[model samples]
Target: MSATTAPASEIQPLPPAENARATRETASSAAPAAIRHYLSLPFAAVLAGIARYDSVSFWPVAILVVQILLAFLCDRHIRAHERMEPKRWAIRYALLSAAAGASWGAVVVLWFVAAPPANEALFVLACIGVSAMEFIARCRFPYGYAAHAALSLGPLVVLLLLQAAPSSFALAAVCICVSGSLILFGDTIANLIAESDKLRHDNIQLIAKLSNETREALQARDAAEASARAKSTFIANISHEIRTPLNAMLGMSQLLDRADLEKPNRDYVKVMLEAGRGLRTLLDDVITLARDDTMTDNHNDSDPALAARAVAQLLQPHAWEKQLRLSVNAPSTLPRVAADPRRVRQVLLKLTENALKFTDHGGVEITVGVDEPDDDIPAVHFSVSDTGLGIPPDAAETLFEPFMPGDASYARRHQGAGLGLAVAKRVVESLGGNIGFKSEPGEGSTFWFTLPVANASLSGATDDSDADAEVTPPSDLTLLIHTGKLRVDLALSRILESFGNRVIFAESRADAAARAARETFDVIIAGTSDAEMLAATPGMRAPLLAVLFPNDRSPASGEQILHWPAPPRTVYAAIRDAAIRKEPAAAQTRDSQEVAPIDASAFAALEKSLGLSTLLEILQSYIKTAENLCENLAEASAAGEWDEAGRVAQDIAGAASGLGLAALTATARGFAQNVRNHEVEDAHTLRNQAQLIVGEHARTRLALASLYPDLAA
Candidate 1:
């Protein structure tokens, strides 16, 4: 017989991915077989070869035992396949396969060398069984299977053919046919393993893609939030800028009574004061609602009776000013409802103020009572009605739009930002209530709301309402002195000084003017009786708030004028309201409603948690990172990395908003959205807008500095 070497291409290697899958399958599939080979191979060899008791039989038994040990080692490696890194794994695996296949071949070759011709049947049977298994389990990678099959069967096939006999040749033919069948069958399994691994790879890529997309979406959302925050910050600053001079004008007009001014001059000052106050209201309206509504804290439980009383008391002043009767009708035993007290009061005051603002005659009435029970929770009802010209149908639908004031172009005359009703509607809905109105064109209009009382109890239940905190002035308030020939200056100084305020007196009018030019004063004490003198002086802009008084009831035109022997209540009110803007009307709008240097109280808890030093460090780090992110975003945009820019913007906005830097957050939010959506030109424009908005000394940044002073340094 002629011999031929099999080419390297006889076995098509498995793909890299398929090899891994085959390794794992090998571990699990080889486990039971491993136990069988480890136990049975040596046992079978010893039992079968012992009767012969020859060197050949002994060597066959030894090789069989070694093959069993190799099978056990391969089982251990396969079991730990997951723990092993794929690097060099294929090479290690191939070596193990060659060793395992050669071990089996050595035992088969031993059979011919050691056993007598009578045991040839045993060799044939062993060769057939071993070749079948190599094809079955190891077939996923044809290399391992082919190695085992050739090694196990090659010796037996050669020996059978070398006999030169008919029966031996026929047996060899059967063996060849069986080997071919196994090899052909192994090819099919190798393809299946490759396909399975390919699917797994595709699934892994899909999962990674989804994770990336989700992350991008989160970043876009955060950026949008920054834009919102930026908007709030910008509006707050703009409001402060607008009201600075307007407050000065109002202060001047309020001083007209004691300034010893002429009647026409007094009237002119009164008109100026009114117009200034209206302007301040517009600013307040914008600033008050500029923040995210969800971010604003709201108390959602209060008594309707108390709310009615507060609103009626607040609006009664307006009613008196208009010479219209104001009435409140509330039940003696009304229950408390789940609702925001401030929002409820705001809604009632807004309705009442609108009623008085429009009414020329008659009166306004506010009523609070329990409405008919439509549900188990019951409802607390409130109504504000006025005998004013009713709302026209054309105007009714739009009355709840922000900045939508009723007809002033017609015979109607009123001043207000159209946010009250809109805000009222929102508050009502938030409290799980419904608000509506009924009006007759010539008669009157009644605005009413019904709120759920699920958590409410009758008036007899113990009230858990917290008393309002008392307001007190801090020690050593700085005051500017402006006095000329009046005993009241000394008395006023003593009163203020007793309350822990430091007073610096100007020796002369010349000195006072010089002091005013250089220093900012919380309040100014002026005891001059000259209206003409003050009318010519330029009013301070959010610097020195003047409180002037005179010798008698004569007009003294100063910033905040009071008659001689000024009432304590009058003096206190002047001081308290000095910094506050006059709301559009006598509406009991938010007190301390000036652009207050951020309520640092908001940071008290945070400071306590992180420690002031740690909090400051985090904030400083955040600012630096945010600035870098902004720059990188711009570069990414230039490079057309919109997704990357969006991600960065999202990060910037999230950090800024977390720091309560609304302006930066709002700006970043919008810019990020534009970037994510691939609005290239719009995104670039928005990025510029954000940079302009969040520059150094930006209002939001300034406010943040107030919160963390060390951050500025």
Candidate 2:
């Protein structure tokens, strides 16, 4: 697992010089401790020899004293100069190791020579065994281990060989072999440790190098970001300065064009306005480029014909100024597209203006139509073609770059900063549209874009291209159109106003009710779900003409339902007839006061037949029953359920007639008949009629007490 580990075959034995250097490091680190440990044996032996024999062991004491002094001196020398080069530290370690080896050897020699022959032989065996144990214990060094083994075993072997016996020579040979094998084993271990040390040093260097590279990369990125921010701030300030003067130019030129002038002079002023406006847009794109900003899409249902025709109208003056003809080629059959009208107009206007700017003597054409469907998602395509200077070859690559004038001279005459094409490309891409151009030199260029379409909020119920004559309301009918989208609100208002009704705008039912109380509105056009909210507002008695869109499940709503499709005007006749009122003002006023307090003859006859008390109780029951029937009939009629409304209306007629309320009976009969004929709008009038009858009944109840003087009480 360690990076320093190598296979047995990969590990090479250290050479003599390196082996000696490494072994000396191990001796300086660990040999002095071993020498001090050996001193303990001398102390133990001296104590035991003095205790068992009645004699003092001066030699053992002397040897122990010398061993202690030698270990202390060697420890002090190693600590004095701890940090040393390998070669110099190796020489110093060798000298200290040799002293430790000789000191240990002297202890062995003293034990063998001074002890009795019987004990000396056992002591010599103990020395040989301890030498082997020391070699195995301190396995980390080669040179230090070799010197210690040699000094301890060499003198003992030679002394044994001098006995001139075959057995002594054999013992000497075994000692020699043991020392040499131990030195070799220590050398191998030292080589492994040295190799691991080198690897750790190399890895540290590599890590430092990688860290430095990562730090430099982060610094470079921060610098680039800082530079970009500085550029954006500078461009934003500069564009603001340029646009101020350009705005003045555009305003002055517009005012001049409006003033009285000759035809040629007016055309010149128009050209000036177009150039100034184009320069302002170029400045806008400069800020966009620096900040990488694009137009915020305000999505709405926009008609292709409206956007194209609007742009065409805007560029007509500039086209005339250049003596070039400009036209819009579009069909009335085009569908309304869900798009941002502002951006669409911007793209169309800029492209058309560009075409006019490039064309010298020929015409520029703008065409719009539906492209081939992509998986049933509607797509609208527009192409602007110019008969002026076609793009040169070199300009094609950087055509969409900022300040890119395909031909410098033509761009200079056109007088824009030249970011129009680039900004247009960004706008198209942001809208998920495709934009490009096909140009042929000496001919013309056609710049085209394709945008995916979605269904407009207004349903495409029919494609009626013909605009009908405006409907003039027979009476002054005020209408409120409640919707958010401008195009939808405008289109619906135009359709309703075609009948010549004054239509107004309202944010909500409460707002409409407040305005209606102050101003007269004959009808409110709103969603059916808002029926309760609309009912809560005071003074809104007009029947709601609920507008339905695509995916609307409720087929019919209210006394009239206006289903707005392609041409909102198609619902003209139904919406008008339901909204109109046919009632005499004087008769309605008189009926409200006199309808409820019927002459007492009707109650008088019933009171004579029954008792006065019984007649009064019966009259109360009849009023409660009639009120329920009238409310049910109104609800059913509003929902366009003629069958239910008629059924309830019959109950009202029977109940009113049986109770001797002649006016209510007559009104209920007429109301029932109107429901049978499916003239539900008349039901609202019928409802008003029943309310008056109910009001008249309340007055009659009050009159009985006032007139009969509680004949009752």
Candidate 3:
């Protein structure tokens, strides 16, 4: 057993005989029994020193010593020989205790068989000590230790009681019960702690992984936004650069004379110039849309009329070129709304341009009306309706999306990238408004939108420029003093002069106030910006009319402040209303009450003929009819009911067509034509679309009430 040689029991061996020989040879110096009996050293030594006791004590102690020794040796043997399963790693240490516990069971049986208990008290005491250790082990390895404890203690307690050792029996039973309870309690606590540890470890790992993933996602988002911004900047810069040179080239070309050149040469130059113009126009539209997308925080509650008039004036040529009648109607005292004038003008121009482009026979009309104040904030609604090639029923809502052409074939017929509506929609939404359309395939479409208006009374300025200067000069109308820009003053003056009215001019607020103090004037027509200063003068009872510009950043003081976006028309209307009024106009007047009602007879008759008297009826009928039409169309396409489906569509079309419901008629006709031509490909989709077209007619009729007012209840 030298340290250099190592113990013989620790050596590896092949056979069972070899293993036993090695174990014995190592223990020779100590005692050959020492290697063979590892755990029994204490028990064996104790027994050998003690005097012989009663058979009860002797047998139980001897058996217990033998099993403990055997258990220790066997545990060493198993560990050396066997490998553990990775999957069972959780109970690796516990498994060793479980194997040791098996030897306890063998000892219990041997003790009972060797000698029946004479003094059962001694047997019970030995049993109690052994079982307690077994129970502790059972808490580590539930099944193995449980078996050992039960066998070691169960029979000993029973034998003690049978021998009239009731106290010993009761004590043994109590010890067993406590041991068992401890084993169960320890096991539960161990398992709960293990589970908690496992969950905490997993949560820490998950949090680390999530943090890494979030960092990656944020980085990607930043890169994407940066790339988008760069691209937009590049487009805007390049477009502007290209347009600057392109504008010069086109202007020079236009200056070249056709009279000095051959007809064909002139035509080639003209074509090239026209192509450049078109490209420039496309570039301008792209830049505008891009600018609007990026621009922020430029809101002003100013004069809206100026912006509206500018857009109308810009688009007038386009409308006139197409022989389409265009008119603008803005009220005299429209509440100033917070908006970007350039963007607003751009939106209006785009809509009007689209209307004129598509319309061949009918007209485009632009109307700006101030809706009654809601929530102390009035809204100004701008409507652009046109008689043109109306939108397809299926394409109306999609019209505002980028690059979505209604008819691909008609794309060449119209020279546009279909970005007009897209740009307009974006601009309107950026200004806190919405853009929507109502159109039929043939009759035309009306696009309407609303924007917030600044309530007049909330504003600080008041128009009291001319209160004192008065001569009850004539029964006929006469303008004592007029103040406006050149174009506005001249236009208003010419209009009044045509009606045999006298006119005076004041270019600025100072001049207008001076005229008010010195001379007599029947009425004062001044730009809205100067109206507040003029109205503050004494005895200025003559009605004050304001001429507002598109970009004039003045707040509306009250309804008395006329925000005539179209200065000419609003000025004329105001002058007429003021002159015809029985009492002198108040300092603040409410919004005009001269709203025209929309005609409902046509709508009502159409509804009645369609068997829909109310909106509910209309909606229900639409749903039912849509469902039935779709089903019939689908079935017909499958069963070759082409002629019947075509006839049904034609009938529907005829009814809609006669009533000027162009959108409905167009959809019905498109379906009917498809059916007649045996082109009922995807009939289900067409049927659903037909239902929507019919439904839109009902919606449009209802929407007209708000627009036309007469159809309201």
Per-residue CA lDDT of candidate 2, range 375-491, in tens?
777778899998877998888998888788788988888785678787788878878788999999879999998777756532222212211111222224677777444555666
Decide which is better by TM-score, 1 or 3.
1
Best candidate, TM-score-wise?
1
- Least well predicted 10-residue stretch by lDDT in candidate 2: 461-470
Better of 1 and 2 by lDDT: 2
Estimate the TM-score of every prediction.
Answer: 0.47, 0.43, 0.44
Q: Which residue segments of model 1 deviate by more than 4 Å?
A: 1-106, 109-192, 213-245, 257-267, 293-295, 298-301, 320-325, 358-363, 372-375, 387-399, 404-413, 429-444, 452-713
For each candidate, what is the lDDT?
0.60, 0.61, 0.54
Order the numbered candidates by lDDT, best leading.
2, 1, 3
Query: What is the C-alpha lDDT profile of model 1 across 92-158, one tens digit per residue?
Result: 6667777777777676666566556765655566567656755655665565666667776777788
Per-residue lDDT for 395 in model 3?
A: 74
Give residue 15's lDDT in candidate 1 (0 to 100).
Answer: 62
After TM-score superposition, the amount by which residue 83's alpha carbon in candidate 2 deviates from its true location, in angstroms, is 5.9
The model with the greatest lDDT is 2
Cand. 1 TM to true fold: 0.47
How well does model 2 score by local distance difference test?
0.61
> Per-residue error at 678 for model 3, in Å?
68
Rank the candidate models, highest TM-score first: 1, 3, 2
